[model samples]
Target: MRALHPLDFLFLSLEKRQQPMHVGGLFLFQIPKDAAKTFIQDLVADIRLSKSIPVPPFNNKLNGLFWDNDPEFDLEHHFRHIALPHPGRIRELLTYISQEHSSLLDRAKPLWTCHLIEGIEGNRFAMYFKIHHSMIDGVAGMRLLEKSFSQDPQHQGITAPWCVANKRTKRLTDPEAPISKFKKFTNTLQSQLKATPTVLAELGCALKDKKNHHPDYVSSFQAPSSILNQRVSASRRFAAQSFELARLRSIAQHFNVTINDVVLAICSGALREYLLSQNALPKKPMIAMVPTSVRQDDSDVSNRITMILANLGTHLADPLARLSTIRRSVINAKQRFQRMSSDQILSYSACVYSPAGFNIVSGLMPKRQAFNLVISNLPGPKESLYWNGARLDAIYPASIVLDGQALNITMTSYAGKLEVGLTACRNAVPKMQNLLGHLEDEIVCFEQLMTTCNQDSINTMQHTQPS
Candidate 1:
């Protein structure tokens, strides 16, 4: 058995019944024409027989000092096939997933499950696959998802994530190694000692930038508490919607902003409207904890992220202004991030996410004033993917929410559409479904801003023309 990473262990040790720490994905597929009624059954059989399981993350379970796993795992315990209740619309599918997402994964077994859900409207079926956050991050999870799919639609021998076979016979990392506090302390001390120069250099740069009075530093804890900062419940409500990727690309191209900046602006506008309806708008721009992927191409299934605080510009009424501010803030943050090494990134990220663990250890919850919420963006396959023979329609990412952080917005751009999944505490974020509508409204408003600004510029050009 291998030892779980300290960061991953933090997720396990701090998990409460009320706060399930996991990330999930919902994939909707169009059932291929001429498929047999027993197609799903056949697919299930294939998965159960596939025999290869990924290690370090997928097959691990708590075993006192470290993680342990069964050499021959029971596949049936991890996979379930469910039929939607009668009149199985998309709404029913989401309701089923929301409930399941709230419940903790069974620790007695593997920390993952796949539900092959049928009975949805149209010639379609959906998969709600969930793995504990300790097992994977969103980026690695996305890559893992490709295991079940095939580039060739007609490829008959595809293996699902659970049964995906490991081809190589080489030994993986030694998970049975002893872990000690003294060793941990020494390792940390060494890393810190090495990072000291980097820290001093960063501080000097900050001081130098302060002398220059840079306008883009977004410090944390500057946000006002709203209804979102209240205590969360054990219940979860998930909402999924898709927007045309071209629309976002068009806006980003027109504004010369990154797609992430556009996403932040959209969220800023949506939260602004959502909170306003409850008469809970904060006078100051809200602070958002945005997790940036720091993983290299060859990184393993661990979470390598840098958490950056972003000014969502909620106080601003104008969409353009919010977009501009988000763009500038993100650009500045990225520049600063690029200056740091991997060790520094981990140090900064640990400092950023440490409070939740501390609060749990203290038998307290996070305060609403700590931060507003989480917003993440993960990129996905550009071309269409097929599972067995069914064409993949959409892939919506379902993410985690903490005690004081009531809501999460995770968007994945799959194929030509951007699928957004909003996960929130059912009690804390009432009518969280309305945020989807607000997001669409903001997109329209931004389009109008582009139109109006273009017209105004044209008018100025005409007025300044020489006779």
Candidate 2:
């Protein structure tokens, strides 16, 4: 039996009746008129073939003090099909999926679940998949998609990604097998002996660099307690909103910031407004927990996860200055990460950002609190992707909001659009929908500023032009 990694074990240990720790997404697809069944069948076949998929090395749990191994792999136990009631609308479908995602995954099985949802309105289909945060992170999940799908639409008859029959070999009882067993034992010993130095070096370097490492602005410690900070119930509520990528790009270009910067700025502004409306704004700037991938190599599917405690300059009234401050904070945080080893960065992040409350309740800690809230931005495919013939309409990622931090905001950029999914405890974020409106308003406000700046420049050029 493989053991769970310390980080993965942490996720498992933190899960309680009220808090089910898993991250997932709700993807909407428009079924092709001619071949919906064929496409879905092919997709299912692919999933079937991809059974017994290996968890990433970093995500695997330590079996003991000495070794780490993959979690048990189970396919039928993880993937399921659910038929929505007839005349199902988006609201009904989302409500169902949200409730499903809120509960804990069965620990007896592998740490992931995929629900193939059908019978939704208007030739559309939805797929809801959730994996324990310990099993696969946001970046790793996207990489899995890349492996399962093709860039070409005509790609067909590909074997399922994980269907491995007869994964286990029959044991032989011959006396000669003892020699082979001894050799295997020797090889394992040799491998561990080689790995020990590297592991020790990483541990020493991580401890030395602990103070200097940070993940992102939002992942920091200064985040104050808001309505979103509370005890969460097992029940989850999900809400999603989509914005055109071009519009955000235009705003970012005008301000000379990145698309991610603009997205975060808009979220900051919206949160600021929302808190003010409730008369519950924090006196100091609130912090956000942001996860950034440290995987720099193309061949690696899993990346190291680190967080930066971003100061979401929500206290700043001027949108432009707030955005600029956020930008600087992010840039500095990223620069600090660039200087450290990936192992050091991940270790530092786990120490600083792991939930203290859960650790205490689980009897693993005495007392402490980590950072508040999680805001993640995951890059997705730029070109339109099809599953079978069904065109993927939108992808919304629903992340886990832990007990103390009842709100999780995750965004995925797909096919030139940003789809933001907000998952929160129903009681903690009663005004969740209002946040959506506030986000839209902030985006428009930025767009208007850009328009005014452009107009001013054009008029100035006209006045200075020679006849």
Candidate 3:
């Protein structure tokens, strides 16, 4: 009976025949000798017993639609067991699972799906999980995984946090009962009534908010006559690579910036070089739609989704100057976010960001325009985690790329490594492999700069020291 929040519903509605909006992860684990089968069975059992709770921003009923209400919430409906055919390499397994995860899940069932993959080339196993964009953002999804995993390698006897115990509370089955019906109806009415005034107030505040200005960071919508921006097929192409988290951290420390800032800077430098190579670099600075989570409080569950358009100072040749520009832009954006409530921020994002792109790509409008790309950095488990004594090897995240914005870059840090997953329209970015190289080159560029700065400092110290 509960309704979806306007923003949540918009994300769900953006999914059309061609494009499916979902965020997913591919997890690699080393299977222990005796516990592989046991781990799989226990994982299935845990998913079956787990119950999904309603979170804010969506009505309880609407939030429950994908989990509690859907008959396909059962384990067999969402979780599947698969074995790779002969000559199973990591590339083959990842490619197969990526395509599977890209397909739309049944709307009539839970809005999530998981594939437990076994019998790969070695002792390694893989798990691929896809959840509807409406259900959880990347940060919340990471939290769920952290909660499910054990910190200790020898940990046993404790079920995943998502698992239901034998004495768990059971949901009522009789929907037609007077008390049940009344409570549902009353809750729906109350939610709607509460949202009405809040929506109006947000609109009023948005009018007064000058930070909502849309900077023209890219060229005017010229209907890019490219294969990438056109209608997409249901099929998808996913690529991933990993780098040492310590290396990135070292770069960040050397530059006096956060790890995320370094990441964005690297993307900026790479994209700049890539575009220059194509001779298609835009004159103005390109803007990135950076999605920032607002789940600051523990009690809150997936409450916030806001975006800031970041100006990637690709025009700046100096790495330090580019980092300084990015730092300033991010600081200004964070200050703006601080001034707004969580509801107001999400509402503003939907109104300013989501609609134009959705409408244009959905073919509702002839010339819909928005930011050029999406760059998301989602935090993952800091410590190494295990599944039934098998050490997790790698965790990679794949995100959605819409028609206009033909590229999506999502990064997650897990097990002291920064895993970067790049999903792009295959035709749009034909030489996507170059990006991996570009990322490496940018990192090296930053390191070189750091080394120069350090040697200069050493020379200055030696000159000042008594001879």
Candidate 4:
């Protein structure tokens, strides 16, 4: 059995009926033209009878404080094929996802499942792959997911995520020798010791900056309570939409910011409008815990992510003003992270979040808010990808929401488009789907504002020029 990391164990320990600690993606694909009706059936058969054993993480089941390989790993239990109800629309498919995502993964088996769903209005089928948070973080998951497909449209054979060879050796499943265990212990000890100074320095700086009330200093726990911070129920509502990557890139170029900065600004505007509609907008700016992957190796084993807090600037009414505030907060956080090694960043994040994790797991302060929510942007396949000759359409990430944090916004860039996914407690966030419209509205607002700014600049230059 492999020992579980403290961060991995937190995911398992925090699992509850209301909050199932898992993350997944919704992948849509267009079936090959003039394909027979048995396309989906054939694909399912091929996957089920592929005779491939599940790889690491997929085959790893939860043991006491370690992960043990399930000798009786069942492929059928982890893979399912379903057809949408009559009239087969995206809404029905999303409803199925929202329902399935609410339930907890069975601990007795490998903590993962892949559902091959068909019956959409178009000639499209979707695969929903979900795995427990303990097994993998978003970055590793995205890499593994991308590996399941081929970039060539004519590539044959179905490569299920479980069938993708991760190149892990047998030692991963075998018992560790005593000397190996000792070496691992010593290595872990040394890493933690080395990271101590960095953690302490960061804490000192954070304290000094907080005392001075620095504009860019965002406290880990400095989020205001609002409707989004309310206790969430088990029921979830998922909504996803895609926007042209070029649209956001144009805005970033005009504003001298990054695509991620533009994304956060768009989310900020949408969230601001959402709060106002509910008449529950907080007076102070809301905070978002943006997760950053620190994985240094290609071997996908366990979670390797650290988070930085960003001020959403939801309190600001002006879109440009909100964008500026968010950009400053994000830039400061990035600079701080740049100064730390991966181990140091992980250690620092662990230290800062340990108390809040305890409170969440113990339910001591049910109403306590730790940042408003999570906004994760994961990189996806840049070029168009295909699976068994089907063209991949979009990849939407569905993430977790805890008791006080009822909403999560996760997006990924794929095929020249930015696919945005929103997961929220159905009850806590009334009409959560409305955020999609709001997101579109924010995109248009940015484009118009940039155009106006450019035109004004051109007019000013023309007037200043001598006749």
Candidate 5:
């Protein structure tokens, strides 16, 4: 048995009915053209009959402070084959996911589930797989997903996540002569101690800048108590939409920003419009806790991410201006992380977020908030992927919405498209589906900006040239 990291244990300790601390993906796939009617049934049966024993995370269950394989693990309970009701439209599919996402995972079993769903409107099916945050984070989760699927369209049979070998076992140079537990603990402590001074110095600068209210310096305490920071119920609402990667890239090029910066701006514009429509737009801008991965390799699956607070600049009416502010804030935060080692980055993040964490777990300061919501952008397979010969269509990520943080927006890039998923507290965020339309409108606005800028540049160049 291996001991749980402090971060992992925190996730397990903080979970409740109001906040089901799990992250999931909704993968839509197209059935092969020549497939028989029993395709779905046969696929499920094949997965059930696989001789491979579940490994690591899928087979790991909580045992006090350590993770141990369940001796009597029930594969049937963790894997379910379900069918959508008649007419099985996308709405019904999303509704089912939202309902299931709201429920808490059973602690007695491994904290994960894979649901094979069929009977959709088109000749497509979806796989909804969710695992507790304690087991894996978004980046680690994506790595597992890539290994389970295939790049070749003709790849045969299905390989569930657990079937993938425990890659961490090979990370150690000599598994047979593993270092002693005392040595490992001491080494970790020494590195953390070395990081303490640097991390604390940065924290000092942050506090000083917060007092000045510097626009570029994002202070967590600056977030306003908007509807998004309200207490949440057990119910959840999920929506997803896809956008072409090329268009977003074009906009990022014209604006001199990263793709993630563009994503933040798009979300900022959509949220602005959504709040305006509901007459709940906060006077001050909203702050987003953007999660960044610090994992150097695929060996570690547990959480190795740090949260960076970003000023969304929702107060600005122009999309370009908003994008500029978003870019500056994000770049500034990233520059800080770049200066620090991974361990230092994690320590600094812990220092910066400890109060908020305490508030979340204890509910001592329910009104105070560090950030309004979470906006995470996770990378996905660039090439088309497949499973059991079925063409993988899109991958939408459904993340967690905490009690105080009522919404989460997560996006993944796959096959030249950006698949976005929005998870929200159903009661706190009304008409959340409308945000999808708002996001498209924002994209069009940026496209027009790109066209006008390009035209002006062309006219200037032509005039400057001698005839």
Candidate 6:
């Protein structure tokens, strides 16, 4: 039994009835052509028989100072099979998942499950994989999905996620409480003392950048109030939309920015439209809390991330202008982030993210907001992936919604497309699906902007030419 890292422990600390701290995904898979009606049944049977073992983080429970395990862990209690009701459409499937995502996970067992869903349309099946955020972050979660699956469609006899994972020799079985609390506290205090200088230097660099009026890094509590900054409810409403990776890449190439920058700009435009329709659009550009992964060698199964507050540029009306502003802001933040190691950055984030704890407990919209919302871009497999003869169509992430931030926008790139998943508090953000339409409109808005900009450049060149 190992001790939970301070960052990983905070997720569990923040967990409550209204806000369940879990990161999940909705996977759509196409069954094999030769598959019989019992395909789903066969899959479920295999999982039920598979032996579940305690993996890192998953095995952890509330120990005295650390997380330990239960002597009696049940596998069946964690895995289940369910089918959609009449009219098994994607929309209906999402509704079921929305309800599934709202409830709290049973802490008595492992904090994860795989619901093998049948009766989906298009001769396909769906799987709703929900795991507590304490166990993994988005990047690690993607790796777990890839590890549990196979590259070959015909690859068979794969065990359930709970049963098997990437083989690691000599699991950490250090009898629980091998280390004393006093020693652990001493080690933590020493590390903080060493990290303080790097943290201060990084802060100095950011301050220097901001003094130049170059918008070095966005500070927390600078967000303008909006509906999205309210305390979230238990009910969640998820909506999704996708665009070809080729198109987004093309736009990125044209604008000379990274794919991630383009994605953030698109979200910024959608949020602008969303809030404007509600007559609550903020006067200043809102803040988007973007998570940056800090994984080194992937030895741990828990979170290794430091978040950056990015300006979403909701204040900019022009799509191209918004993209440019976001590009500069992200670039500046990335420069500062590059100078710090993973541990030093984590220390900095802990200091910065601590302020949001107030809202998490009391659900009171702070006089000053930490950030408006969360936007994450998680990369997926470029090649086609399959699981036991079923073609993996897409993987859309359904991530965590915090107390003050009611909305979360996470996207994953699969094959040649970027599937954007939007999760929000059902009551706080009504008709959340409208954001899908707004996203589509934003993509089109950028395309038109790009074309018009190119034409104007050409006309100016022609007019100024020496004939």
Cα lDDT, all candidates: 0.78, 0.68, 0.66, 0.86, 0.86, 0.80
* Per-prediction backbone clash count: 2, 28, 0, 0, 0, 0
Candidate 6 on 1-467: residue-level lDDT in tens? 55677877888888999999998999999999999889989988877776557565556565644666766777667777898887799899999889999989987666887789999989989889898987778888777777778889889887766544454412554434466777878898888888899999877766665566555367767788888887778999887766889988887776666789889988999999988899989899899989889998755477888887888889989776677667666766776678888888888777766877665666665556878999999888888888788998988889889777899999999889998899999999987899888888877877776677875543442233111
Better of 2 and 6 by TM-score: 6
- Which stretches in model 1 have alpha-carbon errors above 4 Å? 53-56, 165-192, 203-215, 352-368, 454-467
TM-score of 3: 0.79
lDDT of 4: 0.86
Q: Which residue segments of model 6 deviate by more than 4 Å?
A: 52-54, 167-170, 173-185, 207-216, 363-365, 454-467
Candidate 6: RMSD to truth: 4.3
What lDDT is obtained when candidate 5 is compared to the true structure?
A: 0.86
The positional error of residue 53 in candidate 2, measured at the CA in angstroms, is: 7.8
lDDT, residue 379, candidate 2: 93
**lDDT (Cα, 0-100) at 190 in candidate 4:** 91
**Better-scoring candidate (TM-score), 1 or 2:** 1
| Residue-by-residue lDDT tens digits, candidate 5, 96-197 | 999999999999999999999999878999999999999888988888888888988888876676777754733322236555567766887898999999
RMSD per model, one decimal: 4.7, 7.7, 6.8, 4.3, 4.3, 4.3
Candidate 6's displacement at residue 229, Å, is 1.2
Candidate 2: which stretches are off by over 4 Å? 1-5, 36-74, 158-220, 298-303, 350-370, 453-467
Q: Which residue pairs clash in candidate 4?
A: none
Q: After superposition, how far is residue 403 of candidate 4 from its true place, in Å?
A: 0.6
Give the 10-residue window scoring lowest on summed lDDT in candidate 5: 458-467
Residue ranges of candidate 3 with Cα displaced over 4 Å: 33-68, 157-231, 299-303, 354-358, 361-368, 453-467
User: What would the per-residue lDDT of candidate 4 be over residues 289-337, giving only the tens digit for each residue?
Assistant: 9999888877677989988888889998888778777777877777778
